[model samples]
Target: MQYYARIDRSCIRPAKDRQVTKRTAAEMDISSSIDNETTHKARSEGATRLNSLVASIYIFRLLFLAVCAAVRIQLDNGRYLVVFKGYPFYEKRAVRKGTAVICSCTRAQCNSYIHVDRDLNVVHEEIHHSHEPTRLIPLSNGRYCRSSNLPQMEFIEMANGKVCLYIDRYTFYQRSPRVWYCTNNVKCRSYTALSPDMRPLRMKIDHCHPPPKLLLNIFMTQRGKERLVYHDYTYYKQSRTRNGFRWGCTKNRWHRCKAYLHLADDLTIVRSNMEHTHSPHGTPLYK
Candidate 1:
């Protein structure tokens, strides 16, 4: 008896069907990977765009702040002013608990005004004008004045070869290319603002003390020798050096005074010791 091997057809798949199944699975995987890559690319592009937008906003904000600073100016008298377009406005009143200020046109008849916040942002404005805009000239002292009222400025050469700004009777020394401080900067808050060309823009003439006075006087003695008179006290030459001369008080011998002074060849007081044991003799004849 010829017996054929038992074949289980249900356990076997066609080669074509198996191949089709494997191809379908691989296609699905490729499609899923393509989708994942597309999603990741999209996210990356979005993040890049967001960063660029933020940077642009930051730059714009900086530019806005610069513009605000240019418009709002503080005067040397502690007053604030706002310049819009070509017109100038003075502070009229403050509202919102001093957080906001209302500025009015300089012209009395004009109804134009602006409301500015503490940050100098103009929140409200009425820019109507009744007359021509007032022209203002910036001063070296961080103040502004009418163009027609600009003062004449003078430049003087100091003894040490440094140049100083002289306006009225006050003197200012250069502190920077665009600013000058009062000669008495220690106690004075005065200063002058200068333009790029070193022209005086504004001046603050507030001085804490009066101008310095010359207190040392040169006197000729009967022996044709030179003597120094300071504050009614007389000083005679004690010794000489290359840089200067040392002087002793006239009463050094009798009163044993220890006071002395070092005077330069240019008559400049280099150093001094004024511990006198006695009072000044009399009024200086030279003075």
Candidate 2:
């Protein structure tokens, strides 16, 4: 009864031996590798989120600056409106010679009206009417003067789109001539005097002088062929007699007329027979 059955000794191994210890070591190594991989992935995700946050901050700052600029403009507009409303309304004056006033808004829709003060008030004029109409004329000293109590003046438009005012020496009598006086109050830079002889000392020209610089040498192109030929000029008076002529060393031609001769960018003769003309109307020689 005390006898035990024969047991296989190899079937049971020690649980605390080196074979169990080796298996545990392998599992620990695997777990450590997995944990390192997870930590690297988390760090990459965190970097991407930080970049997004920085971009959003930069955009927000830009929007704030734009809003500030808009607010400043609105405040300035409000101030201007207040100033416009405070100005005095119109008190009527007779529209006579030498009388000038800043007439408020001409549009029918607006009730705003303000009479502009003249540069100088007439000291000895009747309230009802003026003796003679204001005359705009140039003084003998080459200055412009306005005589009317309502000195009506305008900028004379020249053919070349330039403008000039007729101001005589008498304009210096005005207190605020710089602000009140102008060719129609547009502010004039230069003025001209009317000459009794009706001849101008100088005239305005549309063309600029010292002449344009030649861009390139003159070469004749005809029938898809070009030859280096010298040019010439010829000028004839009413009698059809040649008075002036020039020789072209490069093109080997004679230049006759300074007005008709066509020059290259280098000022050399290009064509002799072709008439030189400007845009629009062909202006003859001006004095």
Candidate 3:
């Protein structure tokens, strides 16, 4: 260790004071140089260790829910949870079997999540996520599935013959695209969008209100009283084969639309607009 310099001014020879001070200053410079070199070497070593650990890490799948998936990353003697780049990390303490809880992103510290019915389907999610984690980490296998791999459209089908389009679970459940029709709905010009809870939204209107259904609703004269054969809202029913419900034109309930629809559990409209309302514009040609 370098010591502090002390000089005696009284009875000290000029030549002696100069010599001693010069030597002390030179020693301090050398000591500072040595300390800097030591610190830099230590920092470099630490960085190398960290890089090695990151490179050797491996992620393994643990569990999967209805929409969310779990993974664990291990490298050397350390292990960590592998979550989506911007999603919140749900620890064991925070997770409950069937609760709707909000979670912020573990890294990005933005947004929330909701797990409903224990399936943990995203009831609501933020449009933007702050954490943009590294997408790709090369594994031992040349061909492996990871975020870095090429993106492709994924279709999720339910047992009922409906289909939904999704890019990935990261997009959240509410944002996933679902097929819808306006054959039985009063609001015919509405855009196609799933509700925040991943359920269909219905717009209520008066019975006589026109739904812009020029094709389905040809102004039928029922016993000299003009009536709408099919409403504007599409309809849905439990599918015979699939676990989910089948969607169709709501006019099927009245048996007037005569439309045939084969809806799949995945929200796909396999068959749509099955010949509802035979009248070109009205029921009677000469009423």
**Residue 74 shift from truth in candidate 3, angstroms:** 29
Cα lDDT of all candidates, in order? 0.74, 0.34, 0.41
Lowest lDDT sum, 10 consecutive residues, model 3, at 166-175
Q: What pairs collide in candidate 1?
A: 138-201, 139-201, 139-202, 140-192, 140-193, 140-201, 140-202, 141-202, 141-203
Estimate, for each residue in 1-287, the C-alpha lDDT of model 3 and write its tens digit: 99987877675778978999999999999999999999999999999998877665522222224125433343222333334332334423244453654444444455534332334345554536555643333222222223333222233332344443322111112223453333333433322333454332331112233333322221212133222222333334424545433444444444455454554556455665646553432232232
Stretches of candidate 3 exceeding 4 Å from the true structure: 1-24, 27-34, 44-48, 51-287
> Candidate 2: minimum summed lDDT over ten consecutive residues — where?
73-82
Deviation (Å) of 79 in candidate 3: 34
Q: After superposition, how far is residue 255 of candidate 2 from its true place, in Å?
A: 56
lDDT per residue, candidate 2, 1-287, as tens digits? 59889999887778777688888899999999989988988998898789989989988987754432111011111221101122212234535553644333322344544333353222222122212322323333433223332222223322344433322211211113232222322333232332344223321111222221212222322233221222221122111113323322221122222344444435455555444332112223333
**Which ten contiguous residues of candidate 1 have the minimum total lDDT?**
278-287
- How many clashes show up per model? 9, 33, 21
Scored against the true structure, residue 147 in model 1 reaches a CA lDDT of 52
The regions of model 1 sitting more than 4 angstroms off are 1-49, 61-87, 90-103, 108-111, 114-124, 128-152, 158-161, 184-189, 199-205, 212-287
Q: Pick by lDDT: which candidate is best?
A: 1
In terms of lDDT, model 1 sits at: 0.74
